[model samples]
Every structure is written in structure tokens, then in C-alpha cells.
Target: MYQLSEVESNYRRLFKDFLRNSYISGLKPLLLHSPVQYAKALWLAFLAVIVVWTHIVVVNLTLEYIDQPTEIHMAPNLVHVSNSPFPAVSVCRSNMINRGLMNNYAFKIYQHQTQYEGTFANDSRYPPLDLERLTDRLMLLTNFFLNTDGKHLDIDELGQLHNLLTSYYNGSVYSVHDILRELTPDCGDLVVRGIIYGMPVNTSQLFLKRATSSGTCCIFNYRRPSYSQSPGQRELDDAEMAALPQVVFESNSILNGIQFVLQDTHQDDYTLSFLTNTAFRLQIFPQEDYATVQSNKHGEILVDHNTIVEVPIQPKFFDSSAAVRGVTPKVRRCYFPEEGRKLLNQSYYSLDECILLCRINSMLQHCGCASSPMAGTALNVSYCTLLDLPCLMKWRGIWNGFNEYPYVEQYEEGAEDASSMSQCPLCLPNCDGVNFEITSNVAPLRKAFNATGYAHGLLKSLNNDRPLSIIKLFFKLRFAQSTQMAMVGDWVVLLNRFGGILSLMYGFSIISYIEIFYYLTGKWFVLYYRECHKQKNDSNKTELDSSSLHWNE
Candidate 1:
């Protein structure tokens, strides 16, 4: 704004000069020239005021006609950090339900989450975690984490949210796994596997990751370009989002949310006939090195070790795996090649054989494999030459990934059971030969299955470990030859579903029928002998008579 004195000085000088000049220049037109200009200016000001008022009123009326909702974008904030290098770490925020009955601690939980921006983005972890187990541990140790994260989640804040989550998810008698029931259902045959695949926030190829011995840890510090759900739906009407229960995970953040498997192995390949086709929300292997890629031109089956699976990304806040212990080898003793179970089976490796071998491998991995203490020292305890020695056991009733959980094996009404479920019995209270399950995609899977045998109560124990596998239609199949075949059973179930054949009983195939009939009747040749009655007296008499006749002749 111009100072009053400066404006007044210019107006007075210019106004006085203009008035004097006009008054003298045009005698007739100079009448009241200064006052006339002032009157005109006042009229123009009134018109300008009216126009400005009209513009304000129109804008106000237009705003009243349109109701625009506030816009808010929710890009899941997944985080990961680990103290141990090999075992990655993750944390994330999740939704919690009222537990049917509300608790006083509810606000405490919410308050803890608040105090941030309007969007108090809870951390969702990408590292793997068993919801039940992690929650259980958290229930036991809550205060520790709350105190720890109090330090803050940033460099300025020295605490972490890891401890905070574990304590919040302990299972109570009323404790329900809202996440499990929603994610892993009894009737549903599915597994959700996710991986923290990295991508850039911009159009760069560099995957967002932290530096490590194995190149970079694909932690949440980097944006997951394609892993998150598609953006901009205008409304949050997704059932999964609406029904998301309180996660019993130990995290405030999560990693990439991409998945792998959607179907089992055989559905897409002939080599995997025994395997029913199914898909997992997150299909992952025990080892990350073999992260499954669409091995074919089209991204489909994940295959390795002559085994195939539906690939899935590592999900948020999930950690650990089918733990395989390290081995402490002994004399790594000298044993005959035939001593191996492969030779003992002679027919093919049974499910029991597979477990023993796999268990051995797992144990070896845990026992300081590179330099085992047992090597060249304790021969008997460290290395057993015979796998089938009297004491050497064939563990049965062990679980497999084949069957869903909570299904306990029951007795088949009329069928005579084997002497024992497995060749080698297991300890009581533990699943031995009687309770066996195939949980992974292993080679020669059919070689280990019974053509016509299944565990009745298998799910009873499986519920303690894995979810179901088969889809609904697999069991609903009716073969044209079902009448001839007689009894049809759920051979191999996937994600707790029955569809494909994991095994077949003595199916009346041409070869099998021939093999059975050969032994029933003497179809080939059978040698028989009958003792001839000794006719000693008749022989002697006949001889003598012949001699006499010869002499007479």
C-alpha cells in the first residue's frame, strides 16, 4: 500500500495542475471540472462493489449443489527390520475386533495407535509369522514391547514395535484366531504365501531394499511397485477388507503382498498326476533361494527338485519355516549302499522312508553340518549302517502336507488294518505310522502312497499344523466307471479337500488282475507225483515165469 503522505502529495500536485489547466484551456467545458470527475469516480465504485458481491454469492450457491467426499489414500505401510541377518524381521498394523465381548484395554490399544497423523497407519509386517504361535507368545510378553516401542520407530525413537505386537495377540480361552478362520478355513482348501519382492516407487529397475550379504534385503523401506492391491476403487467395499479380523501377528508393518500358488501341481502337468491342482494365497517354499518364478512362458507352476508347487509371495509379518535341524556327523561311517532304505523298499520308497530321509537331512543341517562332532568319533551313536536294523525305526503316523488339519484318522469299518500303521511304530501320544500326512511336493510322491488307503482321523492332528488343500469339485467328481470300481474314497485331499488320487488301492487294472489271478489257480504249471505201489511179489513171480517160458521155448 502507498503511504498516505506520498499519495496525497501526488494527488494534490497533479489535481491542482489539472484543475488550473482545464479551467483556463476550455472556458465553456471547464465548468466544475474537478468536482465532476469526483462524481463519476463515485458512480464507478458503486458498480464495482455490486459486481464483486454478485461473484461471491454465485460461488457460495455452486458449492451447495455438489457434495464431494474427502479423499484419503491408504497404501499399506509394511515394515521390516531384523536383528539376525538370516532371519528377516517385519512389523505392521492390523485391525482388531471386539472379541464378541469388549475389554477395557481396547482404548489403550487404540490410543497406542493414535497420536500420529490423521491416518495413524498401523504397521503391517511382511516377515512370516504363525498367527497362533506369535499371538501366544505376545500374550505372555506384552509390557516389554510396549515399553520398547515407546522409544519410537525411527532413529530418534530408539524403540521397536515388534515387542509391542507379540504381547497383544495371546490366545485366551475366549481367544479366537480371527485371522485364521477368515484366512484359513476348515472348508476351504487354500494356502496364502507371499514374498517381499522389491520394486521402485519411480520408473527405475532398482528394487527397494537394504544392503546385506545376500545382495539386498527386500525390506519395506522400498515401495512395492506392483505388489499392493490395485488403487482407486472410490469406496472400501471389499469383503476381505471389511472382514479383516484382528491379526494375531507380531508386527506393525508388512512387506510385499503378492502371492504365488493358486492350484496344486498335477492340474497343469502330467508328470504330477498324483498331485491335485490347488492354489495358495501365498505359495512359498521352505527355502527362499528357490523363490518360484513362472518357470514357463506363462507364469504358472513353481517347480524344483523334480517337484512342483504353485508359487506365492512371502506375505507380511510371516517368519520361520519347517525348521530343519543341523547335523553333527560321526565316522560318517562306511555302510553298504544296499543298507539305504531305497534298497530295502526294493519296490519303492514308502512315505515312512521319505520321512526318515528328510528328517535325517533336517537334523544334519542343524548339527553343525560342516564339521560335525560325531564324525570319526562315536561310530554307533553317530552313524548307523543299517537303516532297518531291529532298533532302526520306520516312523509312521507322522504328518504330511497332503491332508488338512484337525482330521484325526478313524478305523475303516470292515477293512483289516496292517499289523501297524507304519513299518516302524512311533511313541504313544505322537503321530507314528498310524497318522501320516504328505505336506510337501516331493519326488515319487505316488511311490509312497497306498493305492487304496487313507487315514480317517488325519485332520484331527493336521489342524495342529497345516490348512486344507483340495477344492470342492475334486471330491464331487463321478467317474463313468464308479459303478465297476465299487467304493470310491477321497484318495488325496488338498487343503482339506478330496479330488485327485494320491494313491489307488488294488484297482482292477489289467496288469493287477493278471497278477492276482495267477496265484489263485494253477494257470501256469504245477508238478505232481504219486507213489507207485510196490509189487515186489508180483515182479518176482513174473520174472521167474518169463525165465521158465524162455527156457522152454
Candidate 2:
């Protein structure tokens, strides 16, 4: 007889009891011991099958998980107002003295008071640089006299004037007569060569200057689309609504050619300030035609979208090769790829962001006046004049590799200068998932100066003695779209559905679940524990007998 340790005895008893009650001892008999018990047990098995079958067949229902919650972010907005929002104010306070040449072939404009105008607002009193004033300033600075003796001037005389003007004005100033003669071969015989003689009009050509500071002080107002129909909302006719500003997109994705015309300008020294809302509103598909853009109780726009997503701020350049994930789609669209250009340290950017920056750089290099949308750059931003536009278009065409010149077919492919070609490749947007339409307008804010209390105060503070003749444009933007969000099938709903399936499959109810749990946890465990206890007692008695026999032997 072998003497058994207490631990070994306990394990032996446990195994013996498990064998007695387990399936080996006739599982079907134990499960079908009574009619009522068998019925309950059978119903449970059927319910489980129903749970699995319904889960697969139910195509209308789906389980979705919201990976990212929706949130509102306040970030700096970068906007482009084409056609130079900030024009240069070249005020020429000149009562000029003109000297006429023989047959009035050329004239000298001299003695003009010249100074810069307000960068934000062009004061009506301090007008911009007109043709006459510019000509006068050039003549006075270079000390060049009129060369009107003949249509064609002596080479020596022309060279002297050109050299003097170029040296004095840093080559920025050029005589209109010389330019006309060079452009037109037969201009020598023509009486009119674009320059007005004798009494000259002191007109102003405004140039947009770079911002001295970062903050743009302008008020913004938001309004629903004219087609919007809500309670207390009145639909406006086309005549009453302000027309959207014309945005010209001929060659590039960048909305770089926007023209804001100042209608009914009664004064020359009017100041214009650009206006836009502090935050951009994005509205996805809704029953209403337009987004409900009213300020909530918390002063935030009430936003409702199918799926809420988070987006990063713009103007941050990025490299294309980075493996960063979880970027929102809206943020991704802001990046534009530049093939030949690379930032010093950054490696990623949104599509539109990169293109806009490239557009600004391009305009700065070619037009000599950078768009005012960009700030804190090394180059000073200024407005491009109508005269400077032709040069801009030519340079832009050369860089973009798409010449818009009427006679571009005549030029040989490799004959054009390679240095002027665009080093960056063109970036196109993916239109598959993205589609948006915007309606906006830029209107004069002078009427608001009297209507609104804030504007009245501002008017009094800024222009107390002077009349409120500053030119200000109010910009309004409305955006709408459709977005998808991750969804999860509700657990409660699934449980109810499972219960319904079980009821249809068998006459089962909530009590069936209770019965199954009780049988598995309470009844089955109690029976097994008692059986193990009896086996343990018997094993212990046998072990004691074995120990006694061993001792006796």
C-alpha cells in the first residue's frame, strides 16, 4: 500500500468526481433528466444558434466605432484676395510746372510733392500716384528735360536720359515715349504715343504696400444663403443680394485673380480694409439647403454633420514622404506638392497650402508685388498695377511652362530660357471625394458705419474731423459639404434583436436566460462540489487504512 500525501489525495478525489458527472457518465441522460429541465436546456441551445445566425444575416444593421470625436478648433485663417488687396498709396501733392518742347514732341513734368499713403486705408485727401505725378517725379528726380525736337531722338541724347533716369530711380522708372517707340517701329510718325502733353491729369495709381503688423482690424458678419428656408428666415431676391466677387482661375488652382471693384467712388482719398469672419464654418449635407450658421448660446456656431472629424491648421508646410497617419481629409487638401522645391526642415504640407505659398513666391518674383494674404515674409507685399500686369503674366507663363502668348506656337521648344521655367511641378486636386461650392461678396462698409454702434464708435475714433469716406469691403463666406462618420451597432439594440429572434425561433423569454445561468453557475457548481467532498472523504479513509497497513507491515 502506498501512503498518499494530502495534496495528492485532494487531486485524485477531484478527478474521480469529474469523471462520474461529466459526459463520459452519459451527458444526454444528465441533460434530459426531467421534461421541464430538458425543455429549458434545449431552448438555450436554440437561442445561441439564433444569436449567431441573425448576426450574419442582418445586412441592414452594422457595427461602427467612432474613432475620433468631433471638436471645434480656433486657428489662424489664410485667405487670398486676388487683384492686390493692399494697394500702394503714392500721394503726389504736386502743382507741377511743365516745359513744352518743339511741336510738343516731348514734355518735362517737374516739381511734385511725393509721399506714401496709408497701408490699410487710402485717405481721400492723400491720393495715389497718377500718370502725370509719376512722370513729374521721374523728370524731377532725373533732371531730364523734354526731347520734343523730333519723334526720333539722337542716340547720345536718348542714352543720356535713360542712364540718368535709370541711375536716379534704380531702373524702376522708364520714359513712356521711349517704350512706345521701341514697341512700335512706326511710332515716330504717329502724333499720339500714349503720353499726354500740356495740362496733365493728377490721377492716382494706388499700389498695395506690405503690412507693417500682423493683425487686420475688420468686423465680420455671417448670413445664411438666399435659398435657405427656416423659421423667421426671409428669402432675398438677386437684386437685393450682394453679388459675389469675380474670381479668375485661368491657369492655376490658386484663386489668385480676384477683382474687387469700388463702385460709385466719389472721393479719391478713400481707405479700403479687407474683412472676413474670425472662424470658418463648414456644413455637411442637411435637409436645409444652407448651413444653420446662427451663433449658439455659447457664442459658437451650432454645427451638425453626419460625421465629425478633426482637422489641423493650415500654412504648415510638410514633406510628401512622411508616414504620419490619421490626417483629416480637409487638412490634406490644403497641401500642394512642389517637385523641384524643398523646405529647409519640414517634409509635409496640405495641397492648397503649398500651392498658395508657391503662388505668393511666384508673384513676388515675377510681379514685384507679393499678394497681401501672406505676412511676415522678408519681401514687402504691394499691389500690381495694370501696367505691371502684362509683365507678371509673361513671367508667370514662363515659370509655369504654359505660355499664354498669342504667338507661342512660333517659338521653338528649346529656344526659351531654361532659367525662367518653373522649377516646381504642378499639383492637381483629387476630385473624387471632394466637391464644394462657395458664394461670397465684398461690399462697402460705409453704410454700416452709421447703422452699427461699433462702426459708429470706430468712425468717430478713427476719422473724427474727417468725413467717413474710407473704402472698406465686407467679406462673407458660407460653406457646405457631406461627410461620413464611423458608426457602431448598439449593444442594447443587438441584445433586444437577439431576444426577438429567440422568441420567434422558440417560445423562449428572459426567464430562459435566467434558467440557463442558474443551472450553469448555482446548480451545476453545487452538485459538483458535493460530489467532490464525498469522494474526498472516501479517499481520506482509504489513505488512513493504507497508512495503518503500512505501519503494521
Candidate 3:
């Protein structure tokens, strides 16, 4: 018990010494006070504890905020260039199919069905196509190419119609692409004239046939190869690159961009009311990106017949800062084009492109085929016909889910859980890209033409009452706004904040921490070893004295 008390006293003495010599602000005061000043010491110690707690709380919150890593903000300055790349302009007639061609196709189908009616009347395996419902059937068949959500025919009825059509064409059924090209108005007839930078351009040479959700449309200033071509053939030859349509504007004037006169003449009998309009559907997008009906839906504008529409575009480009690029793509919540391509296994990367591919992949996984309006020709995937519409319609909600949240979680193949299967979480937005904000100004076409003294003879030659639209696309500003992704609280910032909080709370620095560590480890261990050695020597000396006393006695 005496040895135990001595050890406790020694420990108390060591603690008091540590308190007196410690670099911490309030600790020395606690040890220096007398009994009468004990309350003052306690109050100082309590305030120090509150400060330390506040410091811990603030540091934790700062760490939590830093975990997010990235934020999007407008750049400090606008970007100005000598000349900006022109946007790709796509024009689709609201009435997708040609009325005369549709009528002819319908009549051919009716005649074939009547011919096969007697032969397949009693065969349960081969059902006869309904003659009275031919129009509805035709609409259903074309709706697949239009990419519109319409009422679909029954699976059995669609199969019956497909079999009938196959029989009609002598075992060779027409694909949706072929039928749309055959029935849709020719690009020559649709684009009456094309002008760029006040110079007349050959409409045939300027416009290219591209597949869109609203069937085939003519697009200008598009650089990418058509979906029908191989993905490897995207690199254009020097001549092809030189031949691509482009416009340069010295100023943001209405006359500095491309203009077109579009004509739409559809018969009432062949045109569906919902699909037909007296206006042109114009889609404006970046040159490098694919123009899709779903992605460019917000960019679509209407150019009414006999009206001149001016579309002024404001471009905004987004870029990643060096700090943001230091982090992983997942940390930043976005991907560079190369990163996205690697993840998605595609030739190009953009949010729209990713989402479109995601939807197409979902279709292929669920229905075993992609629709005609979808892009999978390079993969050699079968296109969905009237027979596959039932399957496609059944999973329409899943497709919509992908469209709404392209960055949702992805699932493994053939997963039985339908609830977890609809997400496509890998479709992250591109770190850098361009987007165009467009606004339209409309006026009477004849009045504008008369005032400008242009296209007088062309207007006179065409029927004034017919549905025609004149569209002009130009830039509204010389400069574009750039959005930047920056690190909100990187490691450097977090360290600075942590150090500041530490210093504010306890007047601490790196050396203070080192000092505390030395005292607790190296100094404390050395003192303990010395104390044990001294105790051993004293005990040995006492034993020697006892031995001597025994010898004397």
C-alpha cells in the first residue's frame, strides 16, 4: 500500500509538470492558480472546451461540404472568337409522309389483301388482313418510324398484317427505312431554295438525308456520318470536309446565316390530324452531335406557312477547370467525352447521344430489336416493324424512365427485378459541350419578301395559298457564355480551413502538435524508464546495508 501511494503521487507530479510546460493556452493557467483562484481556472478551462468543440463541429461540416467536390458556375469572363462554328439545322415537314405516295401504298395493300382473302379465309395459321381497318393499320405501321406514342394494334393482328404484307411482296417485306423514304417528300421538293451569307446555295448539295424521330429529315451543316454508314467511317476525307456547308458571320445580322423556303403539300385523306401541321418542325443543334427527336424536342420551333421566321441563337459552352479535372469523373458528377465513350462503348459522347443509346440499348434488351427511328444500324440490329410495336409499346414506361433520368442506376442483364431494371445510371453529362438557346421572330413571308425585294418570281410561281414556310437561322451575339466546373472544397482548401479552425480555437500549429506527441510518447517513456532504474538502485542499496548489519551482529 505504501508503494502504491508513492506511484500515484509520482503520476500526479508528472501530470502537473506536463500541465505547466504544455503549449496549450488554457492548460497552464489551470495548474498555476491557487486554491482561492480555483473557480477562475475552471471557468477558463470550460471556455476552452467550448471553443474546441465548436472547432470540431466546424471542421466536420467543412469536410462534409468538400466531399461533394464540384460545383458549376459561370466563367469570370465571356469568350469571344473571330468566328464561331455554325449550328446544324434540321427541317422536317410536320406531315412526314407524302400524301400521294401514302394513298398509292394504301391502295396496293388493300388490293393485295383482297387477293389473299379467299386463299387464307379458312387457314387458322394465316389470318386475313382487315380491309376496313387498313387505314388504322397503315397509321400503326408508320407510327413506329415517327417515334410517337400512339394506340397500337394487337400482337396477333400485327402479325397477321405482317404476314399479309410479306405474302403481297412475294416473301420480301419492306423495311421501315425503305417505306419512309418512298413515302416521305423528296428533299428537292421540300427545300425550295437555300441561301447562306446572301449567296444562293444549291439545296441538293447543302442538305443531307438524316434519320430523326419524326422520320427522315434534311439537315444542313451536319458533319457526322449518317447512322446507316459504319461508325468507323465517321472521319471525313479532305474533299468531304471542304464540301461541308458552313457560314461565317462578321456581325450578328439576320442576313448573315442560312435561309430556306420549305413547302408542304399533303392531301387531307392521307394526313393524320395529329401528325400533320401547317408548319415546319425546325431543330437546331451543335454540329458534332446527333440530332434526335427526343433530345432536340426542346429546340424544335414552328415556322408557319406564308410566314418568315427568324431564329436567333445564343450559344453557351461548358468547360471543366483544372482543379475539377483533378478529381475522378464520378466525384465530379460528369464525364469527359473520352471517358463517357469508354464507359458507354460508343464512338462519340454527349448527353443526348448517351441517352439515345441508352434507350436503344434498353429496347434491344427488352424487345430484341430497336425501332426504326432509333440508331442501331451500325450494330446490325434488326429494326422493329409493325409486328414488334406491341412489345415496344409494352415497355414504353421504361423507355420514358430512361429519357427522364439517364443517370439512374444500371442493372445487370436479364435481371428479374423489374423495379431495378429501368435505370441507366452510366449516362452522365459531358464535362464540356455547347448548347444553343434559340428564339424566333415571325412576319408575313410576302410582306418580308416584298420589303426586301427578293424571291418575287419564286413566290409568284408557287401557290400563295399552299402551305409554305421561310426560315432564317443566325447568331444573336458574337460572344458565347462559358460555364465552368470548379472544385468547391478541394484537399488544399480543406487543409487550410482545418488549420485555421485549429489555430482559432487553441492557438495551435504544426509544431504544437509535434510537441504534444513528443511529450506523450518519447519524453514520457524515457522518464518512466529512468524512474524504474532509480527505484532498482535504491532497493539494491538497502539490501546491501541490511547484509552489512547482519554481518556486524
TM values, all candidates: 0.16, 0.23, 0.76
- List residue ranges in candidate 1 displaced over 4 A: 1-258, 261-272, 275-408, 411-553
Worst 10 residues of 1 by lDDT: 473-482
Q: In angstroms, how far off is 106's CA in candidate 2?
A: 18
Lowest lDDT block of 10, candidate 3:
402-411
In model 2, the Cα lDDT at residue 393 comes to 44
TM-score leader: 3
Better candidate by lDDT, 1 or 2: 2
Write down the TM-score for model 1.
0.16
Q: Could you give candidate 3's per-residue lDDT for residues 1-553 as a string of tens digits?
A: 8667767776787778877877666676666547774686666769777677967776676767656767677887876533456778888776766667777787888887777676542236654445546655666666665346556466666766777667666776446655666677667778978777777777877776665655677778877655553233333322454586565656566667777888776546336532456567788876656665344324677777778888988777788876777788766778887788898676777766666677677788989988765562355676776777877776664555423222244433454333322355666677887667889999986533333334553343565445677888788887887888888666677677767877777776677779888877887777778778988999999999999999999
lDDT of 1 by residue, 160-262 (tens): 2232322344311111112211211111122222232221122111111211111111221221121111123212213332332221222212222221211
User: How many Å off is the CA of 520 in candidate 3?
Assistant: 4.3
Arrange candidates by lDDT, descending. 3, 2, 1
TM-score, predicted candidate 2 vs. hidden true structure: 0.23
Highest lDDT scorer: 3
Q: Write the per-residue lDDT of candidate 2 for residues 99-143, one digit (tens) a residue.
A: 222112222211111222332112243344454544433332111
